[model samples]
Target: ILTTLPRYPIPSDILTKQHVVHVQISKLPTDGVGLQLLELNDDFQFVMSELRQYYDEIKKLKPADEKAKRLHQNETFEGCCCLYAHFSENGMREFRRGIITGQSNGLAMVQDADFPWIGLVELRNLYQIPRHLVGIRQTCVYGVFGGFNMKTENERTLWDGICREMCRPGVRNVATFHRSAERIDYSGRK
Candidate 1:
């Protein structure tokens, strides 16, 4: 698939490069299941409307006060987003979101002007890479605003199990509460 593009997709190398799309896939090789999500540039605003709407939900989860707004007042995010996906029990393909979430409590609002993820756009340009690709799996990312924290042993242990189990063959049940940041196979939902 990547051959159609100008280069083979390398996640680390591509991130180092401009305005390129980062597509992460979570796959269960034994089950022939996979979810693919593209991280686009801010210039692609049309694709980000749903993800941007999550800011409203986040605000509602907080107290009804100005302080709550200030906590995540930075209304702009430099990264891309894919909000929803369709699932089929019959014969079809799926390209969805793969999110690793942490415990909910306290505020984890990040507003970095020069987020490292944003620099990836220019790096891709340097290598004459295309804007679209299937990025290498990024199992661990830190210090980024919307990334997981791999500091504690307990958290690390928890994440290890989650990742392994999610990729297992019989794990057909995929669920997520972050509607805008994830894609849930809701076919069974009443």
Candidate 2:
């Protein structure tokens, strides 16, 4: 559906005016289910209103105080995103270099690229390669954030599996690839 411009909680005048209209599927007598939602519209604000409501909920979760405010300001959750990638291999390589050289943060690097590729790195059991993709090689290497300390085995397993799977499929296409930087953002919230 068409969504309106985004509004954060701090902007009361603009944020309060917008309401999120959610359309859900319902089981009908004949039809098994139905899909419904407001048409995508640029004029109607959508995600921003919902984010504000979520922000309010998060704020209320803790005791009101300076500590709470601080927590709210820095807290990270699934919905409370900082940044991530959705781009290409060359783009990811550039991003990795920037981060290693203190030129960018993980979030900023991923978001900066036109299509963030590191997003696929999040997959645990399976490998995700862009099917029917053009350009790029299969042997390209990628490093996941917090690889050794947090999840040494799972991380290695994922990489190895991806390598094996890609070789089998004969799809040597790396959309996003990068090396690890020394400085790390432990929180992974952003």
Candidate 3:
């Protein structure tokens, strides 16, 4: 999809069927916790379908021949994560992997406020802001492959930690990386 759309941002990660199978069969032993892949609920599925339609429109407007002229940036200006289409398989894996890949890497998925994901086709009117995966704002999905499980009872630990930082003056983009994943304050920063 990116070959056609320009500067698409990645929004969230997903667990693929193959990944689940690989973990169930090949991955080494850990804490012996059973794995659980997130199921797309009605709302998420609808949002995904709508997002795809928006991208399809972009493909229609921009021809594949124009690929070279595209801006060609696949990451966010914040550098916390790479931006991608919300529908791409690679994007989904990146979201999951960003949190679980490293020995202590883990990212807390947070709900986005005033998320610009709805009506992406219309959003294109604001062409200045491309709706890539990072545009999704809210990431509520989860898939435990090896060991990136949410340590606290509520997954909002990271969200809470970053809440104050987010509300601070002039803090436009706020994110916690996998390396600092453990720093998410389950204690509720508010």
How far is each candidate from the true structure, as Cα RMSD in Å?
A: 19.3, 21.9, 17.7
Which portions of model 2 show Cα errors greater than 4 Å?
1-44, 63-190
TM-score of 3: 0.27
lDDT of 1: 0.27
Write down the TM-score for model 2: 0.18
| Residue 188 lDDT in candidate 3 | 31
How much lDDT does each candidate structure score?
Answer: 0.27, 0.25, 0.27
Which digits, one per residue and each the tens of the lDDT, describe model 2 over residues 27-60? 2111111111122222123333433444455446
- Sort every candidate by lDDT, greatest first: 1, 3, 2
Please provide TM-scores, in order, for all candidate models, with all chains considered together: 0.22, 0.18, 0.27
Worst 10 residues of 2 by lDDT: 93-102
Minimum summed lDDT over a 10-residue window in model 1 is located at: 119-128
For model 1, residues 5-48, the per-residue Cα lDDT tens digits are 11223244333333222222222221112222224233234323
TM-score of 1: 0.22
